[model samples]
Target: MDHVPGGFALNPRFHRIAAVEVTEDDLGRAIPEHVIAQLDAHLGLLGTSTGYASGGWTAADFARMYQVVYAVLRDTGRRPGEVTSLHRDCLERVDGKPTLIYDNHKRRRHGRRLPVSESTAQLVETWQKELDALPAVPGCAQWLFPSPGQRNRPRRGHLNAAQFCNRIFRDWIDELIPDLVDEQLDENGAPLAYDRTQVVPYGFRHAYAQRHADAGTRPDVLRELMDHRSLDVTMGYYKVSLSRKQEAVRTVAALAVDRHGAARGFDDPLAYEVESVGVPYGGCTEPSNVKAGGGHCRIRFQCAGCDFYRPDPSYLPALEQQIADLRADKEAALAMEAADWVVRNLDDQIRAYSKSADEMRRKLDVLPAEERAAVESASRELRKARSAAAFVPLQALTARSPE
Candidate 1:
């Protein structure tokens, strides 16, 4: 109370350190790939005769631990607590595919069915068999990861997530510290040492979100997989790294098309961003318009009819939607007996957008299957990035007013 500004107020007179805010640049607590690999390698040996047996850790304990960690990583980054407390009958078949019937303890959501990879399902089945083979430990029949037998205590509970995190997982990470190094090179051209703090158990969940984000998973689809109720919460789990964004831009550049649907190629994909200005659903390449910040359009922003407008397959959905909206508007105008000029303008835009969409589709249909898949993947990433950034207002970010 003595440190309070007026001896009674909540505010203190001492220097107040503000909390660090999260930004787009923040990658959250996702573990580095190398460290994850080390963990996986060590965990893979569990259930085998050569698994870790020191520090009072038994083969059955190793098997249980492996299933808990491995399943979380493989199943879209489930919470460790959820995985640890999973009921013994968690595995079920849904729609002819192996599905995990687990509870979302954090969200109070129960019986959430998540489809697991074939290999993961097999692992779960194999663990069930192994558990059956073990000598019946009293009070452990109902828990998938029941607490191992203790000398004087009742072994009637599941593995404690907090205990595992504080001791078992911590020790495992420490053991692999010497081998964990960043993929990026430092100023000396040597592999930088990885931070061990980043490989915490919960970091696996962030890693799962990032793995999908890097692979160009749509935000809505990722949100569903994460069981998040809002895109904002789902997006918080991952950020597209700078390197991944640049790679996507280069890949999508190869598929750019002009207003006429003719394939556009850039000799230097890196220069494409510098030489153009982004407009609605596409980019403008006219030098003057680009320099004037895309405001000096000679044709009054008729981007569909503009010669410099370049769009790729990434904008196909938007283009198609715009065309449909224009058609609907045209019908409404005709019913309302609107002006001839307004009707004509809408007709022109619909025709232009439709032509562009058809031409892009034609170009895409002719590409080899492998190239087409790669192009589609790259375009999805670009679209995902655009959708993620579209909602943030520039003025809201740049405004200097405290309010």
Candidate 2:
């Protein structure tokens, strides 16, 4: 078949088209945390005489080449063809940092330099030593990852790097694709499980994109890192998982939950009756309709420290409960390894809550003794109820370490 030059330039102006959009199969098939831990262990065993699984492929023997390939894919997000074309001394330090020069095989370009993470640079350095130790392929001295000593084509490098790397990936697919469905002669001779993950070599690249997206990397930056031709390709893998979406909804709802509201501001020296649905941080003197007409306040829930806010002594219990709820939310966010921005926001809100708590305490101190006592008693009762509601087993608790 004759090669078509500048294929992208050829466009059909005459015929209408319905291009088939390819759905992403591995939507959320990121390398699981457990699997990542396993990979780390596998990486550690490399260069050492340790038997890894039953593949008869140990680190000391056939591991170096595969390890280098895997590390490049993991760290650089380079394609298989690009990996095969790499040469020794590919490292180019710029601004006191290591960068890798990768050849863009798909684009038919030469020497595309990309800044690399420190850990990946280290991996490349380690792989360099192993590459040096291997016997040089007569005609392929420049190829960094030369094909392992072949019987006939000894001089030629990995003729098909994509296929070779794929075989290595498949060999380790058991650990990589633990949830991969298997063909079996079951009762129906078919499967019912959802093949959510793509059990292919490309999963590594997919995983790279997915991880960056989850870490909240911008599309443009991610595109540069992944070496994608279009932002749409990078974004295609930036799918929001159901759990993440649900967490987002819960976070927003938690901000807007029903809370005790004080009917009147504390500045009004005369005592006023506390309405059933009064907000505790009462600063809005605007008529309800007028307040509604203005767009919602960005810091609506931050009533405690608001300049126009007044904390009613009557709703001290509810105010304290907000603090407790914030503590719980902070714990939940940390447990989930929620985004850095989210964790920081929760921490900032906690600081804001502290200010609000101080404000409430100051107002209560000036209140009549009887009124102050009543608020204190309500707070104590609420604390006890909350404690009882969130009971943990004694067996789960261990004594704190002595300082």
Candidate 3:
């Protein structure tokens, strides 16, 4: 077996176990006690291992990994890759609300708010507490799960690598529910029954969706909560069983029938008495002999044709002047605010860079004259390039252009 990067060995024939296909059956089978113990020990060593000096797995990494895989399994009836758009930061709490933020392969962040189940919330809370207790490693502050051997730089966090950690969790689930691997074949030669007794890591998410349906959550709400771009996708993926769909249909049908029975005729006197009065049609004008004249009649509802119509040309100049003044004030305020914010942020960045540069210079000062001179020359060129750049002022950049 080839030595995997994080204290584990993989079959030599397989280039990477991380990319290997893991079926429910593969994960559902019983894992011996020794293997479980080994896995736990490995996870325990992740934070303290000096071998992972570059950066190693941290508690946050495990939490994030658990959430992503769980969401995929829950949101889609199937596992990962079956669902095309899984959020990367699938378990973030924003403004006291659970949100799922996805990053594209290019590392751009986009996200959606997720409606969390009580169980999922509890699990997340437990994980958050555990993560808060772990000490932050220097230089790995940005990483949710730091890897080993990364002392001075952030590690490239792997989504698939995190998912692979579910192997141990899956094993534990199988131990609790031994019948998970058992299957019954149907007439179509496909499995009619698949074991789903104990909750695996992925099962947490499945349970989430199921609970929502059981709670009689609306389909549109479910679609939004699950962060599905299309309602059809949500229906196809998360709407697992026919029984749930039938229940939803029945509920909607009952509501429709009730609405139909309760509806009143348009001419009902009681309805008119109860409802708020709307604008009277034609506004107190007789229905007959309506002509364009001194009467309530004009050319297509014009003042000449209708008594209610009145021209207001006198307010035009005043309105325009008011709008112009308001626009000028708005522009000035926006410009000032933008300029202030930019200056503050820029000052912060400048201070940080200056501190880094001073530290570098101090380190070089200890070196011989030739090395120090070379470093100083490089620094001077960098400063010149930065100063000469065509960066526009922040206010000018954000200012609206004249139409």
Best lDDT among the predictions, by candidate number: 1
Location of the lowest summed lDDT over 10 successive residues in candidate 3: 252-261
- Compared with the true structure, what per-residue lDDT tens digits does model 2 show for residues 358-403? 6566656776898666555443332232222333334335553332
Task: For candidate 3, report its TM-score.
Answer: 0.32
- After superposing candidate 2, which stretches have Cα over 4 Å from the reference? 1-29, 43-61, 174-197, 241-244, 255-403
**TM-score for candidate 1, residues paired by index:** 0.60
Q: What lDDT would each prediction earn against the true structure?
A: 0.71, 0.54, 0.37
Instruction: Tell how far residue 338 is off in model 2, in angstroms.
Output: 39
Off by over 4 Å in 3: 1-109, 117-126, 138-140, 145-166, 174-206, 237-403
* Candidate 2 or 1, higher TM-score: 1
- Pick out the ten consecutive residues of candidate 2 with the lowest summed lDDT: 268-277
1-403: candidate 1 lDDT, tens digit per residue = 5675553444432336743433421347777566777666677443444244433447756657554555555454787787877788988887779888777876689988877788878777887887777655567678777675455665677777875676666766676334677778999999887777777777877778877776556667777777765466666544555677688778778778888878785645577678776665677899999998777889877789988998777777778878888899999999999999999999999999889889878878999998887778677666667657544523234332232
Q: In angstroms, how far off is 122's CA in candidate 3?
A: 6.0
